[model samples]
Target: MQVETLVVVPVVLVAFVFYLTHNQTGLPRVGKSGPFGFILTALKSITSFADLLDEGLNKYGSKAFVVPTMAGSLIVAGPENVDLFKSSDDTAINQPISVDESLQLMHTLNSRQLALPFQAVVVRTDVTRAISAFIPEILEETRLAMAEAFALPFGEKSTTLPLFHTMTHLVARISNRAILGPSICRQEQYLHDIIRFAETLSIYGQLLTWFPRILRSPVYFLLSSAFGGPKEPARAIIPHLKMLLAEREQGLENAKTITDFLINLAPPEEIADVKLLAMRVLSVNFGSIHTSSIFGTHALFHLATLSESELDTIRHEIIEALESEGGYNKASLAKMRILDSTLREVGRFYALGVVCLNRVLIKPASLVDGIVVPSGYNITIPLKPIHFDENVYPEPYKFDCFRFSKLRASDHTDLKYGFTTVEKDFVPFGLGKHACPGRFFASMELKIMLSHLLLNYDLSLPGGAKEAPKPIFFNSHVIPDTKACVILKPRVGQAGQDL
Candidate 1:
């Protein structure tokens, strides 16, 4: 009787799932008819959605039907949709559902009020004004931090290191300088703790995202309590920020940095929320450190592995720009066309996230001629296909640093899409309003780090080591494999050129 009950229960559950799925309405017709048949086909195609999108785009042109998962159907539009996605009418497209686990993880590190504080901070004009006002000071701090970080271990007797580790330290120092000011930024322990906090938060968040929403908070509490809670790493720095906030509040008339700027924007009622301010500081650190470091590492790796002639060309450009402009200001950095192209190429080839922009439909909408995406469906542009498309980027697999350079030389103009300015065919920093606001600071940080590294060190793969670093692909994200190494030696005659 027990064996029969178990067998019957399994059969009944399967039948019920099939009945609910088939009876459900709004399943769009694709290359076939009938709900169950189409769903079965989609289930088989789920693992190869990237390939399916590519095939659909090639065969049907610019639009394709995809099942976001086994249960959801979506119609994806191509690059033309970028503009549509950016416009006000498209604001109806909801923010993608964050994994409950990820949210719970964030909650552990930050209060609910702090973790999801009005998106206005990122998407509105007031924040833009604050950022613009802060850029010059931010750049200055970044330059000083870059110099100090590289100058360490003193005499510089050929220090070779992993790209990620080098970048993590450099970015942490630079970001801390901008976010927390020089006194705190220069402290080694503070920087290390911030990185540790970010790493821990990301791991917990990723783990939690796989579970159902109802179970997330309890899971987070259990895991965090067992795993040393957010306070473990945060303890080193939170008190300092609170003290800084208090000092700024008491001396409101004299404060001059970003913390001051943030304070001024707050109302009297909001001024006392030190915990909320600390969360913002931590969020800024997480965003700035991880993405900037990853991209910077990729840029340096590409530069180190490229041929000497290529390296010389970029170096010459940098020197000429510095000589003409007197230093690495925004204008001078912009003039380093080859460096820009190389950076863009690395971002393009590496393609930050396998899936680029993510959106959740808020209302049922017809995308193209015959495809409809129901409300609540999640959608993403699979960047790999677009980035790797041969038609868009000829010989897409090969690293051609000159790819964008050739285009610029021919057109005599930087690439512009309406009001958006971008280069070549890359969108690593993303596009439109949702684009990373910290990219300017990130660019400055990368340029300073790379400029110093190139001017002072000779770098290469270890003897007989493979020419190029191998990238490990995990769930569409590409990261340099841990085994890769580069050798660095002090530049013999370049000591006098240090600035």
Candidate 2:
């Protein structure tokens, strides 16, 4: 009787799931079709998310299709359905909170930060305004990071380091100066842990999802630090954050930083816990550092391939702008237009994800031609194909350094064509109302690092090659090849430039 019950229960459950979803509710699937196929597709999706989505796009061709996940299938909206994604409201579909809920961020982040708009209160506002104050320190950190990492390679003698690792560290230190302040940023142990925390977000999310609902909290607690690199640091940093908060409370505020802004946010609660506030700080540090470091590595690789003449041009632009604007102010960074164009083009060419601006349905939502997404499914655009569309980017696969600068300089140009400006056709930073609020700060960091590199060093690949090392792909995420080496030789007249 017991054996029979076990087998019958699974059969009944399968029948019920198939009945409810109607095999993902008759959505056209990317891989195989039917109930058993979803399991196989889910495995493939985990192993290679980009390829699974690409297969769906190739098979369906502008028709919305489904990519199966371990939990269920997600609707991959086609180009025609971009409006459905862009114009949806939070009540209908939510962006961050929806994704965060799925990832079980409630267990990870401070409760006060759960639905609070970091865009308006923290990530976007304070950093964008006070970034200029950080430039002198950022330049100093960049120089130190570079010098320490590459030993002042000079003349024909160059320091060869893995491009990705070096950039990750350099960008981490620079981002730390902005996000955590100079005192904490310089601590080697703390810096190491923060970088580890950023690199493991996926691992943590996956670990949490492996357990059933009742077991999730136990699993999170058991494997806390193993998941996100922030767990241990969160515990250690609480007392320090408490000190900062107490100082603010006692009206001892002097320099307002990311710490002050986050502490000062008027959350739903009248008085926020200091521990939760510390976790919030760690969250911002991990996310900001991870994105900036990875993208900065990509841009640096792009520069490593530039001709000596091209190198001189970018360096001169940096110097000319710095001299004109009287040091590294906002106007000076803004005038480094060539660096901006290169950064944009690298992002366009090598973005890690196949789609952006993912919004999970908060409620059942209707679409054109009788298509309705039931609650809980995500709506995502097909990004790679649109990026490669000939009409959108001419010879789209080929990298062009000035692709966006020319667009900006064009007569009667729409600024949307520039790489930083996200539009329907371009969304490296996403599009519409929820486009990345931290982009201004990110752009500033990228420009500062790249400009510093050009102004201080001669960059090349080891083989005297004309091309940058080919980037590797993990599913859809393009990454700098960790094993590949980049050669850097310092130039004259820039030895103590930042110091």
Candidate 3:
């Protein structure tokens, strides 16, 4: 009467059914075409799928399938589909719910409530209106941030430092100035707390995604309480924000920055929710710091590795722009075509987000060629394939600092360099209506940081380190491997030039 026989029978039956269905379905084979192929396919795809995805796209044209995880299948859409998917009119087809979910998970861990303040205040506007109100405040903060960063230790060193860490600190300072204004920006502890809070939340958010919903809340509380979670930072900063809001209400009459805009524009419901405001401030910091830092490092690293003459030419362009305009401003920075091209090239080569631009199919749709895609199938664009295509960009592997500049030079008609524009071919800031709204501020931040670094320091790889830093890919997103070091040294005569 042992129960062993009963358990074994059901287990065997289930296995047999799985085998039959897996074979009969004729769904895309992920790895080797054999029984139980999905396991091997998933392993292979995750390990080196970028190259494999590219190869599959080359062979299959517009639609190919890759098995990135055994949990689900990835539908690799072609360039035409990329255009359609990005510009999709249907909500389900272009859902932003995933990002929203991630934000909610962050809120749970921090024990903070969620609010959509940004959607009401910022994302509702067209680009022109958004930029007009925000750009000047961003620029003013950029100057203050640059001055603060240079005053720190290793601030004026000519020796190379760790690029990612240095850039992170610099961007944090910049973001604090923009989001919190000058008084809070000068507080060292507040700046440090913001950086720590962002780093902690990112790790926790990733963890919560893999666990069951019921377990997330309790687990988050345990982890966050053990570590100094968002609560600690919120506790410290909430009082300051309240004071700031009170001061503003009392007619301080400062220039209308993001903080002021959010306070004034968010719906009463959202404004009453302090947690939502905190989340918005945190979101801005998270978006601005990591992204601008990566781009800033890439641009600096490329400039450092170039030959002396190339470096001199770029330097001359910077000096001329500065002299002509008498200083760095939005208009003068825009005129530095060489630097623009260099930054664009860096973006093209080192885009951090990989294959996970998820869109849930809203309706039965077909491509121009009549390939039918049923509703509810998730569509994803593999950024690396588009970025590395030899047809789109000749000799895609070679890092030509002037690649975009050359394109612009040959065809001044090409408007890829314009700040507010986006395209399928170049999507570092993403594309369509949901594309990053803060790119103008990001561009100014990168330009100011680079302009300051180039004018003040000489940078290079450590002696005997022959190669530039290479990126390590996780899933599909590419990140600079932190193990590589770039040395920086202050220029001899340039020490006090700007000071």
Judged by whole-model lDDT over C-alpha atoms, candidate 1 comes out at: 0.59
Winner on lDDT (1 vs 2)? 2
TM-scores across all candidates?
0.78, 0.88, 0.82
Q: What lDDT score is found at residue 93 in candidate 3?
A: 63
Report the CA-based lDDT of candidate 3 relative to the real structure. 0.62
lDDT by residue (1-499, candidate 3, tens digit) is 5699799668754664343224322224345655446546555654566766666666676664544332234556666667776777655565454444444444443323233435333533432254434445555665565455444355445444677766777777766666667677667777677767766665566555434455567777887777656665565556655765778789885644456555665556545767656655566666677677777777777777877678677777788777787666656677667777777887778775566455655566665456666554555677766777899989998877788767777887446655335687777777776677767767766776676677666667777353568876644456666666676665658522342
Ranking, lDDT, top scorer first? 2, 3, 1
Residue 452, candidate 3: C-alpha displacement in angstroms: 0.9
Top candidate, metric lDDT: 2
Q: Which numbered prediction scores highest in TM-score against the true structure? A: 2
Candidate 1, run of 10 with poorest lDDT: 415-424
Clash totals, every prediction? 1, 2, 7
Q: CA lDDT of each candidate?
A: 0.59, 0.71, 0.62
